[model samples]
Target: MTEGLSLWSLGLAVIVVGALWIYGVNRTMMTVPPEAQKLSPDSNRWSKELMRETYERVKKNPIDIKKHLPPKLDRRYIVVGGSGLVGGDIVAHLLARGQSPEGIRIVDFAPLRRPDILGVASNVDVIKTDITSPNSVKAAFSKPWPASVAGLPLTVYHTAAVIRPGERSLQTYDRVARVNVGGTANVLAGAKEAGADIFIATSSSSVAVKPMKFWKWPLPSLASNYVQVFNEDDFDQPLKAHDEFFGNYARAKAEAERLVCAANQEGFRTGVVRPGNGIFGDVENDVTFGPTLKAGDIVSWTPHVSQNWISSRNVSIAHLQFEAALNPSVRAVPPPCAGRPLLVTDPCPPITFRDFYSTVSTLSVTPVTETYPPPVLMLILAYAIEGWANLIINFPILTKLFGWKEPTGDLAMLQPAVFTVSAYTICDDSRARKSVEEGGIGYTGVTDTLTGFCEQMAVWNARVERGEAGPLKGKGAAAPVVA
Candidate 1:
């Protein structure tokens, strides 16, 4: 009886200590920095009137992505992942600059879904190719170009990638590696075999963002690594261990970037563009804005978080600029932009999560609601979810024994790694903005954050007005809580 009582006492003590530890960590991390607070949006910025006026302005003077496009090159182009966000924009920019539709091809796993891209889809070649399958990639590349642009040099833009920001388990690394790492190698080989002269792959700025350490016991302070300034400095160092990256997605991207850079040669030039976190601008299914607009109501824990965002249009511009810099016809000698990664972001200061919610809430004709739970509680729940997920993933037999199923959608994304990536992140794109002659890509962003968000919201609002907007469907209906 005494031993039973002692065991119960021990269990209760353990629970109490765990609870206290979580509370302490939460208290420490909840203290917002004065500098970050200054970046938060003013309450007035959320006013409906201001947002309506901004929407009006955006509709009146829509961002002219064409004005920022590079001069149309006399070359045939192949954009891998061209049906998606950045790749789709690259195709649009190419067509906008008068590149013949017959001169361009889109090789992607997904079909052409974007309405804007669909309008011109008939004119361009759209091939459904799975990058993970070497044979599929080879066949896609081997497909003949039309006779009109057959003689032109080939420039390939590889923008396809599988994104899972919340997953950090090594056991699940293969899920992302197949596409991000192995698939990149497949595409690289295919591009070379196709006699491509210029190759550029889309990478992520999160490669430089380290994981946050939130369990500092003795020190009553926030995680020292919570605030990050991302640039290309990490590229100069050796790749970090998988554990060092924010999640599997970032680690895979880093490896892919390395392969692309290493493949740079005298005849074939290669480069990478790492777009900042929160890639948006596609009204249908972009990671940032589209999901929120679709959901209409959001539950968030990142009101205090601040990070950089990049529009698809700006990311596309950077790719074309990189291509121009690497083009042998444009440069007399080997350019500095070759075999390097350039960071790109919207031309605006990093804004708090509140700013994003405010913009959507105010601009949308459909009533949008946002609920913020205590961040500490969310963090605790995230750890629990991750632990449960890891158990299910590491031991598949549990499914047979207990009928356990893997988490999906938003629940699957509630892992601890989400907090790390969602932390305050600032991206510096000075190198990319430098002139090509000065050893940079000469990238100039087309729209600022507010204008870009306003433009997208304007489109969605117009859709709602036209009675075309409908409830979001499919597994992608819920937006991941991570930025």
Candidate 2:
């Protein structure tokens, strides 16, 4: 009789634990704050016809970024990471505004791959240099410019950084810190050595993101703290603890930003531009929309999460605006914009992940598809993946013992850190928009999020119609867990 009672007790305990697990997952996943709902666009607004019309309209009358381009200065340029999304756009804008190609030098780890900049590649010098190595950076910057523009003052735009949003472990800090932190220091030293009068580093708004706490006891009716408003206010305060940031990437960037801002002096003006989350506007290599478009399908767990986005072009514009603000000839002595970080974002309100997925699905001729999984389930999987990754990283013998390979590509990106950044984040650009005289970057976004998405889709659709690319085949890769 006692043995039977014990068996019954074990069964009851199992049932209770299972029931509690289900309840916690469902409650956490389903609890969206009222403010988040207000921030998200209505589901009714994301119809196929609407997205199609927007695509067509944008194709007919595309955004004219040239109109918003800052007037070109005569200064010679050294754009580190110039082949990347933001740096590429900076190079294109400089050329579009009558800056001579000879006057621009691209110091990047990667060769020029951007189609837009490839046309001018021959005229501009491309110096492949790794910023992590102080010697490499110094040599790249020390290389003599063409005699024609050698006399012009130099402005350096440092835009390179390894982006691993899902990584939060201090164990993995060395990898990112080598590039984001050490590289920034190397680039800053090299620029000063090269006699650069102005330096602008590309920073991320993720620096201000606080980690999300979803498993609090007595689970609240709403996840109010998950919704955050981001600006430059954090710059005024002491840097938070590394764990306080969403991940290692943000922590490294925060340090890099401090280094760049503190380097500002009477003649060597320095600043940082913090682009809002979800930077898109590239046909390839964009972290947000491009991955879904490339895969031709998305497995989404964030349909209701809303976050601000910024376009690469607009980010580039902010950099140039900062340069103008700090230019000795353009502004008064001790420029108000120098020695600070400015946050920038699209001019529109935040949009839900569903909105982004729907726009791509509706407009892509490649037949994009989406599946919405439970957010809590994905969160659980992220933790598991992170554990396995850390295990393999910490113990190389385990791989040989169990034939285990480290996660790569999208799978490697799945981690608990992603959840913090993927939460509802709305960035405000008002501080950056204030006039330069008032201690701001005097920034403006040329294209809003929807328009930017529509414009990119139109380009892809045109390429498909012209038979330049695919109606691709096979199952698409898994969508990224974080934008």
Candidate 3:
């Protein structure tokens, strides 16, 4: 009898332990951060006091108009984010168009890297600028223009922005707001002060997208319906301020767009372009540093999700063509590119991630299938990781010792929505093309763009194999080699 009792007791203990473990796992999966509560202004992660102080600084130092009257119009370009990928390409395009190096000025918070890729344009003036600070922006614009292009109206391309996943957290949201929102105000004010009549700014399609509302498993299929294809008309449908993940970034961008549009009257003619997923060839980062899978590299395939993508080169071209359409003659009164933001994207069918990946695949004798974690399981994992991050960041001692910061829950929800189950995600580039006879800067076919990207990757990979390119951090590390 005693032996029988011992066996029963052991069984009971095992059952209890298993139940406890399951309970803990379930709780973690359901956990949501305390900060992401409502989709309202009260849900803004930033401290109110910090926002007020930053706004006051922007207002105190208004743009000086005396120095910037009668805008010059002879291709005297002032690129705000000139060191970045798209911005760098714009500079390259300018050089290709035979614009003198002295005629171009690049203003960025950080110095440009890989000047060799830019043909080592010795005459291009590089200004170190902090867009968030009104004084810094003023100082950047105050620099005298080259005498040769001094009389021509300058076209300001303000593309500098703070875009990162960590921006969703309370610790970093204020910095995003100050720079993206208030910084844009300063740019508009500075442009007006500098007599910059033509302005082009870069915006993202995220401004019009809403977070996915996932369906339950078994009955509804656990996927969202392809009910809507986002267009320029949907600009009003923005992510709420209290959205769990991308809300802050979306809200801040919306504000910046508003600022740019509001400044499009009389002396200032401003236009904004909203791009879809932008991917392209990176010579500086992809070649000189590390190389990922290149053309002719054997790569496996998977049934990947589909989304719209645009080439970086096309984005650069569209900027110039839009400017040309707005003001045909150098001194003619240009029309305002306001009322609506143009949606610029490649004229290609929605391509699956696998289709994109296959561009670099080698000619293999046999095909291979790539496998990925189940979406449901991955979602659960995201919740658990986020919960763990919240615990670490909330505890003062733990944070101090481990240097723990709140991780933006981007991977948990936003990424899954984008990669696994996105709705009709194509942007219509027709209106922008019709507005200008250039037709969206004569977009390159999707296949050609993919081929071009793969070719560049191949070149870089060959260099790495030959030891011409030194050791890279990893397959594709995120190092700011360009900007």
Candidate 4:
């Protein structure tokens, strides 16, 4: 009886000490705003590790044989948002599959916070340039790939955007749009100039038929998120900017989609990938979709329903699949991939908001406090805890030698690694063909394709938790948990 009691006490103590350790680190960690969070020192160091991991997964082309194209167009690949969550996974998959890193180019506005990009510095050519700028976009296209690639044998994988705050005003919208829509235009312009053969674009699944739930949320309290669509005539009402956050991102993306579909060239062809939400990994530590708050009902999602989720890694794989289709050298996947909209998501049926959250709940050792901690103090407290815990875990000798308290906190963010939802949207990927045939993008009937994403999200999340990502160096990771 005494031994059992002692064991229980030890467990409790370990848990308590763990909590204290994280609390100390988090408290001191400096925080950057959502819009401007850059890579920290520790995170940067870790990013190098991620760079290595990413190169391992992404170096190989998923398509072993080019479907029909010649050898010159087969090897070179470029992903614009390679540092972002979804883009990051695509890079990882490529490296893991054994694509030559020297042949890959990773271009993003901001660097990644994970270690994948950091480790592959030697293998990859990381470029920081604004694709919206004609010169910049042209330069990227004109750049030479591997020695084997034709004089300008480059394949374009575009995912750059000037979204969010950048879309807040008409001026902002134009600026942002210039990057997405204008950038694509330039990519084509340069592709033509450089004799590049194929391009694959990351298009949003935000249908023009309906305003997204993100645009509808907090209608009465917060600024409206819905804005004017490119095809406003289709909507029941005239398109207007309803959301402050909606300023220009939607319009730009909408316009960009229009531009890509109209991409008819003599030598080159294009493919578009529309992935529904649930694409969470880590970059900004953001889960844009959640229960009832900001998710889509891919199928029969009523206002009573929650949002949909997708694993960014899976989305990355799907996008990579599209990339493989573009390679002109080896036989890839199904032919006729160019100029097609492939909807990539999950395979599970929908679930209620509550059930979704219950499945992804994590073990948080920190006591929930009602009082709000000041932002500055919060940073201090968070880092203090994180530092102490890392020290204890990485240096166990210190634990025994110094008699340190064992940390037991939300360090196990094992659960809810991806976005946790109480409810989600349902979708149908099978109908996407019809939408494409109709010169539009959507699933057949009313079945939203996002329904498939939920099931895959679990598997992708599991893989992410299996490793400790190091994207940005120098900085401690803010809890990936939703605030």
lDDT of 4 by residue, 117-222 (tens): 4564456777776776778866765676667544445666777665432113353345566677888787667656766566777765443323222212213122
Cα lDDT tens digits for candidate 3, 236-305: 4543454533445666777787778767776677777777654454645422112233222212111233
Error of 1 at 75 (Å): 0.5
Candidate 3 has what TM-score?
0.71
Query: Per-residue CA lDDT of candidate 1, range 206-280, in tens?
Result: 999999888876554656687777799999998999899999999999999999999999889999999998788
| Model 1 stretches with alpha carbons more than 4 Å out | 1-20, 35-50, 472-483
Predictions in order: lDDT: 0.86, 0.85, 0.57, 0.46
- What TM-scores do the predictions have? 0.93, 0.94, 0.71, 0.53
Against the true structure, candidate 4 reaches a TM-score of 0.53
- Candidate 3: worst 10 consecutive residues by lDDT? 294-303
Ranking by TM-score: 2, 1, 3, 4
Number of the top-ranking candidate, with TM-score as the measure:
2
Writing each residue's lDDT as its tens digit, candidate 2 over 385-404 gives 99999999899999899899
- Displacement of residue 465 (Cα, Å) in model 2 is 2.6
Residue-level error in angstroms, candidate 3, position 78: 0.7
